[model samples]
Target chain A: MSETMKAAIFVKPGEMTVREVPKARIEQVGDAVVRVVRACVCGSDLWYFRGLSAHPHNSQIGHEAIGVVDEVADAVTSVRPGDFVVLPFPYSCGTCPVCRAGFESVCPHGGYFGASQAEYVRVPEADGTVVKVPGSPEDYDDETLASLLTIADVMSTGYHAAVSAEVRPGDTAVVMGDGAVGLCGVLSARMLGAGRIIAMSRHEDRAALAREFGATDIVAERDQAAVDRVLSMTGGYGADAVLECVGSRQSFDTALGLIRRGGVIGRVGLPHDVEISAEGTFYGNIGIKGGPAPVRHYDLEAGLLDAVLERRIDPGRVFTGIYDLDQIQAAYEAMDRREVIKSLIRF
Target chain B: MSETMKAAIFVKPGEMTVREVPKARIEQVGDAVVRVVRACVCGSDLWYFRGLSAHPHNSQIGHEAIGVVDEVADAVTSVRPGDFVVLPFPYSCGTCPVCRAGFESVCPHGGYFGASQAEYVRVPEADGTVVKVPGSPEDYDDETLASLLTIADVMSTGYHAAVSAEVRPGDTAVVMGDGAVGLCGVLSARMLGAGRIIAMSRHEDRAALAREFGATDIVAERDQAAVDRVLSMTGGYGADAVLECVGSRQSFDTALGLIRRGGVIGRVGLPHDVEISAEGTFYGNIGIKGGPAPVRHYDLEAGLLDAVLERRIDPGRVFTGIYDLDQIQAAYEAMDRREVIKSLIRF
Candidate 1:
């Protein structure tokens, strides 16, 4: 292993630069070193780059990744050298009472990896955070791995929204965004037995993909009109469940208005200083279940990898543009211009 | 039956006058005529009497009662003549799907009884709305029956709040408001298996009853300090469930703030405007389950009668003042002055 490895670092707000940094090494007995195969930019990742987040400057810039286990410490037993693995973005010890209760995302001892986007990453609690991919071809390609990368973060977030919404068979679920997480919510709702999945998207392209991913309907309206469309489609009873995938106030209002009485609203959107009306929610008997996308709770690294291996869900479609590690700024520019659904960086 | 019966009539706001009206006769096939043994005034009834409600003038006031079945219609089979029964305030047919689902308070064919405080009340859907008292004693008295009268309204509202809050065994529940409903909430929480019950009351006398009824703690504070007091008692975790028994905005905020994360807030308070902020409710993942009291859902008439018969709860403590059929105005004035928890009008 080289003493210094290539990493993409956020030098300042709205800037990314490639640099050779000391490769991540096992700092704890439960840690492991993984060689990155593919990593992608997430919508939240953009928040830091756009100066909207409180993240420190010159920090590691990516979180979603699929990699090969290069080395494991004495305490690590889940994966070995040369094994393909998917890493949960927010690493968890996965042995706490909360994790035992299947809420590992909020595990007390969890920490995130890839603070500086490097080729080799150090994963804490490797036995619990990394899931070895099974039955992979000898020469697996980057796109397949990049698509699988999403399960570590955004895809898992979408799945969490679906689960929290209590999407059941013959129930209508409305997704309130068209981003990567929203698209995954469309797929997750279908997988969870939602009879009719409505994806609210203004873009024709995203709406088309949502349809292909099992969205039964697409409501192109926003705000009050969007609520009216959902109500009309459900015979005035309103959707049985609603998924708020966007953190904006408009999306929150739309999700609340689209659900019926006694309905559940699963909100996974991360917002800055968001407030919900107490009286409005109380009178409607609306139940809300969500926070910070409990990525570890869903065991995304393992469950999502199996889905990829079975070809049950194709998340790689989220990555529309790819760039070598040196073209990181160009990748961000394309994503900012909305020219790509997601941009990937290759080693 | 007499040709004319003594009845209490609210001819104008803040005044009640007794008038001779024709005795109520069984009009519907399923109806029964109940000779009122005891009746009580409710806070909501005062709203109408004070002209603060949307109800029209000359509307029959007073919905709580315990009475004897004097006559049964042709189709009536649940109760027979001489049977002492407790009437559910909102008369439900009890055969609709909603009623079948145990939401009888919102029964499609249900409506309130006693257009005027009459001596004989014609109860519609008698088979569904009336519960025959078990083991009638030879010496049946008004005090025992008067306490049982609350089962029809305030007591039921309190029970509904606890049920909607999903108060479970070993959980802490906070009841907001020191009104009759709030005091009843303390009893309901005990019945529902709440390990720790916190009653928020400004009145020391009501707080004492709350404790006697099984409240483990008393929060005399009203505003944000009350919320802090509840949190302080719960080790900063907040109550596992909260009952919003008061309809004011302050009570609403107190209830919302008193509940822990993932806690349920049951709101039975009927607000005039029904307005609440969305931001405060959305982020916490709190669930709310209630609007108007579902008096019919829990078979309050039967349940409360059973409780009374078994000597489990005594609502008579709430009735601190009593008046004749003609002293209704003074009764209202006394209640307004907070000199009485509840005032009963004897016909």
Candidate 2:
């Protein structure tokens, strides 16, 4: 293996370029090195590109990718060389108390799965962080690989939102967002047996994908008007539960208002400037929960992977654009312009 | 049957005095007049006497009492003249959607039982707001009646804190206040089958009551140290659930830090300067719920009142000071100075 490899780095605002950086190795007790096969551009990736978050000066970027295990430390188990695997975003030691409790995304000794938009990634706690693909990575086409990438982050997050909100059979649910994660929330709510899924979407293309994923209705209204539509739709009460796929002050407040006397708002979107009225939530008996999705813990087990493999649900339909790994910059720009739902990058 | 009556009002900060005011009349179709027999000083009552909340100039102040029905409107079907009852703190009409969903505290037409501190109160939505105390007003003694008074607010609120947190058998519950409500929380935790109850109490006397009320342990430690102790006790995790009975910033944050993954925090204390990190809660799988307790919905049927009436629990022991109605000023001063746990006023 070469000592150096190409990796994507964020140089300045709205500018990303690739450069040769030191390649990853099996340094830790449970580490494994994997050769990248596919990576995906996330809506949250724009947070830094748009100057909404702390910028990294020539620092590695990206956290979702699928790969083939190339090397492993002696302590690493459950994965071997040449095995296809899905890299869990935000590496976690599965044996830790927090991970055992199912919050693998915030494992105490864990760190982000950054620099995965490169030739290889050194995943810590490899036995816990890497899930083996059922077959050879070459068996799946590029689009199918992109679909598998969703399992590492967005799809698992949507399932977390649905499960946290306690979306049950015969229940009606409302999803707040039109991004890839929100569309996946529509799929998850349907899979959870939600009788009706109402998605709060503004764009037509994503709205179409939401319907393809089983969204029964789409309301483009925002703020109080959106709350009004939801209330009126459920006979002036509201949906049985709400999936806060958009983590904004306005979206959080609207989700709070949309629930009836007692309902839960499952949130997975990263939050900023989130000020909540304790009194407002108390009176409505609304329960808000969700953080980072323990995607690795859920991926193959939550029926998402099998459903995708069996062609039961088309989670890959979220990919509206595709590019080579060197074209990551253009891919992000297109997504930022809302020209594509999401972009897939082949390694 | 003359119109004039003596009532307690907040004449000014640090000055709660009794004065002659117009007596309550059956003004609405669902209104009923109650002649107060026993009223207790709530720790929250000092919100104004201590100059915390907006002090109303000569306005009604109390919201918890056991009283006799002096008169009733035609629509008052549940109680009649001479019937003794427990008045729900938030007067709910019991027919609103929120009320039907079992949260009467936030009923659209509801208001606080403010005039209960005085000799009489006009209860709106009489059938829905008043619960018959299972006997005549002359049946129970002053102390038992005072105990019944806890059903209206404090005990119900404590039960709310426990229930909202989903206190299950064999679970560890931590109460965050040492006042009347906090003491009641200790009792309620036991009733809910909590195997161990830890109270955050510093005062020896209050701690004694907490122990008597079923607190298995007392941790006078505050802030991070308290959280550390709780985490250490639970094997580096934290308590299964926490009851936030003191709503200050420090206590709120401490309670937030004292729960293990997937634990719930039930809060009932009036909050000020409370800030929560959304990221912190989501990552921990923590759910927080509690506001105004729907005492009306829980009083007669949730088994709180029956538990007390059956002598299975004594919520009235929270009263460590006894005074006549004329000694209301002394009552307020004692609570403010921490001289008494709580005070009961007999008419």
Best by DockQ: 2
Give lDDT per model, in order.
0.76, 0.85
lDDT of 1 by residue, B275-312 (tens): 54444454454666665555655544337667766667
lDDT of 2 by residue, B1-347 (tens): 57787777778889878888888899899999999888878888888888888866778788888888999998878788999888878898888666776778876667677778888899999987887888876777765777798898899999989988879899888999999999999999999999989999999999999999999999999999999999888777788789999888899899998887767888888887787677778667687777888897777668887887887889998989988877888988999999999988888
Q: What docking tier does model 2 reach?
A: acceptable
Question: Every prediction's TM-score for the first chain?
Answer: 0.94, 0.97
**Per-candidate count of clashing residue pairs (backbone under 3 Å):** 16, 0
Name the candidate that leads on lDDT: 2
After TM-score superposition, the amount by which residue B133's alpha carbon in candidate 1 deviates from its true location, in angstroms, is 8.7
Q: For model 1, state the Cα shift of residue B208 in Å.
A: 4.4
For candidate 1, lDDT tens digit of each residue in A1-347? 66988888888878888888888888899989988877777787778788887788876778877788888999887788888877777777877534554555555577666552568888889887776676442456665676677777888889888877878887788998888899998988998899899999988778888999899898998989998988899766577788888888778877878887556788788765555655565555566666555565564433666676667888778787988888988888778777887788776
